[model samples]
Target: MEHVAKTRDRITLTGVRVRAHHGVFDFEREAGQEFVIDVSVAVDLAAAASGDDLARTVHYGELAEAISAAVERDPVDLIETVAERVASVALAFPAVEEVEVTVHKPQAPITVPFTDVAVTIVRGRA
Candidate 1:
């Protein structure tokens, strides 16, 4: 949930690659696959920018690690659930007001040829 005030400034992390086991099939869970992720978080950056303080703004490096850990920690059947988990992690940061998460499965077990399969979600304080 979004716990922060409305802000135009945002931090974005794109194309994070991770190996994870997330699928409906047992084979998929056993084999695992490479997942590409994208995350955008909205936050107020004026204080941090003006004061040159890291504490007042979202730390993207930590955010990336957190999202990666979130994806790696659990096994789920749907990317939607993965997106929610990432959103929760981003919003847990004090400066984050909103978050958008996209989970990409490049090697999904689809019968037909496809470039990628992904789920995107946006969350804010309730």
Candidate 2:
């Protein structure tokens, strides 16, 4: 008989863009800015695979809401802070083993015109 190998599944939510006030400049808070978020979570899918239940899987909508809430609730000076907050929230889920969050700012007020600026962070169970 041949043995089957078990593998973990990863869930990802990408391009979750939200306009918020997150920047080092005062105008960022007063006028607000546009930001984008991307999140990836690694989870154990054995139970969800066998059970076929939504509860067994990570709810991306909830994750997006959480991220949005965090960003909107607090004003930060850097995208690094935003990334950290997003990763921390994603890792709060029991099923999530690892999380990666990226925050993108396309309209950053820079002296030189560029495509975009972003910050990425990865967090896992310790």
Candidate 3:
């Protein structure tokens, strides 16, 4: 058999806010904070576009809910872990060929002033 590279269309969900306790510090875990999540999935959309069926495409509403659950339900020390978990969930979808996840911690316990702290990860099947 021969192999062919496939090009995928992207579906993105940005700025998904959730309240969660995820941190190494005790104070952080005690006082939960709002987390921002962003997710992007790559998939073939031709079938969905032509068929105009919900089953043919990955549902953004469902995907967003799943991602929010991952962030809120589980507490981890690093945002990297959160990003990885989110990517795994996205990749599990049949329509998703690849996924990229970003977990943002805006209210971090930092002594200096900063905009945000985040971790981004990309995962896919070859």
| TM-score of predicted structure 3 | 0.94
Q: After superposition, how far is residue 1 of candidate 2 from its true place, in Å?
A: 26
Tell me the tens digit of each residue's lDDT in model 1 across 45-86: 899999999999988999999999999977999989999999
lDDT of 2 by residue, 1-126 (tens): 999443358888888988888888998889997788889898878788799977887887898898888777688898998888888889888788889898999999988979998888889878
TM-score of each: 0.94, 0.89, 0.94
State model 2's lDDT: 0.85
Better of 2 and 3 by lDDT: 3
Enumerate clash totals for all models, in the order shown.
Answer: 3, 0, 0
lDDT of 3 at 69: 89
Winning model by lDDT = 1
For residues 27-112, could you state the per-residue lDDT of candidate 3 as single tens digits? 88889899999999998898999999889889999999999988887688888888988998898899999998989999999999
Q: If the candidates were sorted by their lDDT against the true structure, best first, what order would they fall in?
A: 1, 3, 2
Poorly placed runs, candidate 3 (over 4 Å): 1-3
What lDDT, from 0 to 1, does candidate 3 have? Answer: 0.90
Weakest ten-residue segment in model 3 by summed lDDT: 2-11
